[model samples]
Target: MEEKQIKTPHEVIASGGNVIKTRDDHSLILVGSDGTVLNSNECSWISDDKDNAVDNKLFRSRIEPWLTSLFQSEHLSLLCGSGITNAISSLAGAGTGTTMGETTFTNYKNEIVSAAQESAQASGREKGNIEDQIRVANDLLRGLKIIKDQNAAQLEKELNSIISNFAKSILNSENGIATAEENKRENAYRVLVNFLLSFASRTGNKERLSIFTTNYDRLLETGAELAGIHLMDRFVGNMMPIFRSSRLNLDIHYNPPGIRGEPRYLEGVARLTKLHGSIDWIQNGGEIRRIGLPFGAKAITPYLEAPGLDNANTMKLMIYPNSAKDRETAEYPYVELFRDFAASICRPNSTLVTYGYGFADEHINRVIHDMLTIPSTHLVIISYNDPIGRVLSFYSESAHKDQMSILMGGNLGDITNLANDYLPKSAIDRATIRMAELLQHRMGATSGLDKQATARQVSIVADVSTSEE
Candidate 1:
């Protein structure tokens, strides 16, 4: 038997590389940032077992210290994708369904699958599988829309249904069931919101919390409103609010009336940057206008064909799933919005904390990878399943894994259990302390993920005190 070769981070960087791309030996051999080879294949920071469980104190002990460290940073940003919405939807009694692509193109699934089968038969090889064919059909539909052909009518109709379903699903969760006692369970959104509130009280840092989400839903908006927090989304007008990118650049500062009072920057304000177009947004004469009505109310108008071409504009404004997304993102509003996301990642001392986001989008992933190369930047990925398999090749080939932290499985589920746990406590002070405990214990760690990365600043800890954060 021959001993396998391993590469160190220094060697990888000295070789004019920043990530570990691959290995000649296809077997599972874990490599550290210092280039040490270990028998294990999992990331040093996370465990491999799907059923491994950690108590609330231990889970809190693991997450809180890291969160505390993040709070210590002058610049911090939170980036959320589809996973957060799914977690909330599940909590709201709406079961998670097929991907947005499958839901939108449900009517053409058979046709697409048949086409793939025929192509395989013609080629006498495994060519377009069902998934591949579905992708191709979606791309074809997107191309038709881009060219302004009438053939995309069906695609538009299918998209309307998907948007309406998503709207209704998210809106229903707005009222939300009481989960105060259930706080001990790991609910992503619940803990995220609570953590933001708690951190705001502990730190006088007046810097606005930049929340960048890919979802078009209004759950977070409603959540913030219900909590009585100031959420600045850059739409200024009251009667008919229009999105202005410049408004986000403006800051609010308060000066004390007394001579000795120091000027204070307003805290607890969050700037929401919706990278993908929001359901409430409609383009009028090239300007993005927002409807003050609820998302569910606005989402169904396209399907009704209510009044005239004016009403039809709402449905046409949606950015559908599949290949068209890249092109749609380049258009007005989205282009500006995506630019904000890119800029947020590059901020100094910026720690990009992600929840429920799978690094599926190439464009978004590219920005993150670029940011990692810069100094004083960190990436924390918390997922219910293996979060690094798709990026393992990239990590293995690069020398920049030192700033990356991957937390998978255990109590790292999309929603904090405490988010669902509703309890009755009249004692505000005591309940606050108990609430903190519940939020910490309720986590859904990554589970059922295939492969894991184990190089660089990664370590697996059974005890919560192991982290220095």
Candidate 2:
């Protein structure tokens, strides 16, 4: 038997000739000014006293503070992909959570299947997922209607059935989350709360965080509620929230009682945009709106399923997965949603952080690519593995390599490990930041003169620490 060959990080880097990519062997890797690799010597990382060796701690120490500073950028946005959904789904929910799996019926009208396959292949996918099927079906349905084809009604019926099942599956997946307590195998919920709060916890002075997700699940909403974070989105309404094209650029703030003329932005308020549309969103009488769906629901909401209503059918779920569709539809919500995304991240001093995103969506990736055109804007890619070489390819093709930061490997991408080991506390104290600066100044002033004794410098550090406490 022959042993399979696996390339080391050094080999991967050399093969690309400076286009460093994520390692497939699950070795810890970092790219950028703070780059590090923890591969070749796993044995050395183990010791009698410590589970994670001193070197491992050192690697983490560098990245954590660096990430902390990046999160405090003038404009910050987080883009989430299906990686997060899979991470959450791994937990032991009471019932099977939403799987967002492939279409149940492989049997499609021969022409329809051909078009769908072509659509999937155009995007580099081997076959269309449920979203692809749905979009293709709709497009085909429209064409048939235009030509007055006799099969239009039949295709519409199948499309409706596919959508009904898809929406119900989404509801089921979210409901499964409610059945969970603490998933003992991996407490993803605990880490999820921390992961969200870490980025969302801006002081009143910084720009409000913008969180966008391709996922249709409501995990972010649920997580925000649990963390006591306020989310402002484009949808307006309470009973049945309508997606408005034009609304005031509103925000949440509070005024300190003693200070009459000034107001402070409320802490932890982030603008949420579901770029691919959400499962809860639907179109009724030519207007898009969000319906009330409880987390971990037992059935579709009565408000949505009411028999007489035009959109009472679950087929109206606003998830627009098939990107191949034309963006010219009347009142198209995706264009509006994407405009929010582009406007949020493509500005000066902006930082976009991606978690669990595989970079599969070309539409989203194009915006990211354009954002990097601005020398000041930055991107941070954090994922367990590249799966395909998309992550590496994006890095190599970028004109501004210095503006990108990447952390890849299984340990770094795990929600729990990322939250606990890498993320800084929710709020880093301003006084502590100042005290460190003071210490650095003291060290610089005393370095060359003190060769034998360091008592004075040590005292200065202690005094600074005492002041911080």
Candidate 3:
């Protein structure tokens, strides 16, 4: 990760408009010291003057500090949505941008199509993608089964095709990743690693960071591997990992002397949970298990080509293409996943920093709302745009307005900008803290320095210690 100085949004705009639909972009205003708000791309107040251009230090000075503090909370959780995949995948050929995309099996039933269209309009979109279709399909699938209709089989077949194609599109989007050591198209993987490390680089004293994502892709896991980050989930095994319901709260620790008093937390370890399940996961003999599904492989081709596998192979994948919009959390595994999410963040002094999440899942949103009930818990959302205005709407309607923070628009939401500029340099947090203590001690030894003077010295030292060489 190259360290870049804090520059203005325009100067630091290294990414494309991958996270689009900036309808609520202006909802979160960017203000500078002059009380000037920049609602547009350029800063009119400073653009004309060569030396007076508005640097994005306004965001750095404001948002970054809060994020730094939040990331250091005793309980820190990160909720990632499709926007992250959209941003990172954009680094490769044409980022698919939030849509699961279309499938060849578009011949959806009349009711399913109608429901999708209505759902699309409700979300302020002209049309819905595979997700909308699949969600409607799930609703119909359950209804058909309940009534014991003869048409249930046909609908199930169509649903399978839709889901398989949907999975294919997701795999295709992940082509940005590079498995070959020498591959040039590895920027996506690098970004993924940087993003994960930003959160995974936590202090040993605090609990392991909890990461919950709605994406079915395996980008996070791959990135964790590349970054040498150990990710712990419910699944446990060597050959085949089984999803256990127990909250073992397992973590990685090491004895300071390699054998002594209360082991210390090892760095670069995190707890991961795919809130919507994962592409590599499947239900086998009533137990959820994970398989060796290669990341970025053509979705169902490998399975179909295997010696003993058939077309039904993809069917076994545990990924259910639904966001539980209608409270579908009651279903198996998802209920447990939501329980993990709730337990992770719905505690005192918990801070959840959501990136690329748009508050689309009502079930997850409900837990977040409950988390906010804890006065010490905080919610910081960084997103491309509030397409459906849900992010902004949630903030305005919440009684705990003071506990929430929003950073929207492509300038701040893009993954590259986020890594190089916004998110706290977790690597330097402890160093800065230690240096501050040393400076305070040295200053106090010299004289009865005023509190203001001592603080100024400590702040300067911190800036120097963390700044890129």
Candidate 4:
């Protein structure tokens, strides 16, 4: 007898078995005996573009091998991990070094030992005084080691204290739900702050410098404050003073004494330009009031400053998400501020380095796209995900595919490459050579300049057009 094919859900389940059912409309459902549906076919399995997926897979296949080869070596892993651990340890210690302090001392001692040995070898003398010097050096090294150990213990205590406080704050007696969003914001701020610090350290000089962020959070300001750099947030003329005060007072310890003076616009420091209103800032009674800083440090002054507008409330300074194009008028000082920011970044030979920002906001994206159109401007997008680059690439191609061959041509890579590429070649190359020397001078410096440097060098190659003219 031929076996009856399982057709209907009831027929298949009746034989004391599970049944898989597909509807006439290509919907899939798994049903059990008692009319229990396991999975309903609400979503389609096939994606929009199978070719794109295939292309990505192929690209990954080619790139993964190279990445694996680059990172797979045992020595590379050890060195990378050691470097990261050292950095984390140093940051964890902050003003004081615990484990990092010891590591640093150990490193210094090793250097001293190597230098002394070389000196002894060159002199060709078994001088007893040299032995004594070595002993003294050893004694000093031992002292440093002791100090480091003590520091480490102190750091652990401090960390434990902080952790305990954080735990107490997070676990409320009343509400069972955690402040997860607050924590996430805090974490995001930390990450952004670190990136800004790194950027400032790299680009800051005795020349003109500025930073503009559309975020309302004080993360950038906090990071700049920790790094001992003054952060100035540009709001509407009315809102500037309050925002400035709030940012300045974020950390009382870091706030410069007597901050009542006129805002001294300094060069070579972190200038935070907040296109949108800040979290701590509030518009009240035709005036702006900036509240406590991060970690809840209250401002000494009221910080209730007003811009030049007569109707401050009507001015609409804060640009929230989903802001319509109708809001982009001269009446809106915040909008004007964003336009000014775009102008500042679009200056000759100016390079904009963006971190974690997807440029999805049409307003910001349009500004960036316009900047790219400028012959003198370069854009360096540093995103953890490919979405920013992909979007930018798409825009670039859509706008100027005929003119420029590369999509997102200006060193559009990940965070590390973005940091390395944004600076002058001389600076980056010098850093590279110095780092190489530190690691092992015997290896010598890596030959050939990076792409940016090479491009600059080529542009300056005898000025053939001028010669012809």
Q: What's model 1's lDDT at 295?
A: 35
TM-score of 3: 0.79
Task: State how far residue 222 of model 2 sits from its true place (Å).
Answer: 0.5
lDDT of 3 by residue, 163-272 (tens): 77767767776654443333434776777788889898876666889999999888788789999999999998966678998886787878767666867679899999
- How well is each residue in 172-244 modelled by candidate 2, as lDDT tens digits? 7776566666554236677778889888887666788999999888989988988888999988878777888
Lowest lDDT 10-residue stretch of candidate 2: 16-25
Q: Model 1: per-residue lDDT, tens digit, 1-469?
A: 1212434333322332222111122322233323233333532332446322224443344454454455445566777777676665565454552244333256566666666555444433333432345445656677888999886897767645555565554444433422222442224345546634543332234356778877766766755665555777767788667878684376555775773566665645667877766666666655677766553342345443433225544345443332123564576666777788788778677777776665555567767888887888877665544333433444444566667654433233335542322111112323443444354467434223311211111221111122212
Local error of candidate 2 at residue 132 (angstroms): 1.1
In model 3, the worst 10-residue window by lDDT is 15-24
Clashing residue pairs found in predicted model 4: 237-307, 238-306, 238-307
lDDT of each: 0.51, 0.68, 0.68, 0.36
RMSD list, candidates in order: 12.2, 6.9, 7.1, 27.1
Best by TM-score: 2
In model 2, state the lDDT of residue 70: 75
What TM-score would every model get versus the actual structure? 0.62, 0.80, 0.79, 0.40
Model 4: number of backbone collisions:
3
Alpha-carbon deviation at 166 in model 4, angstroms: 23
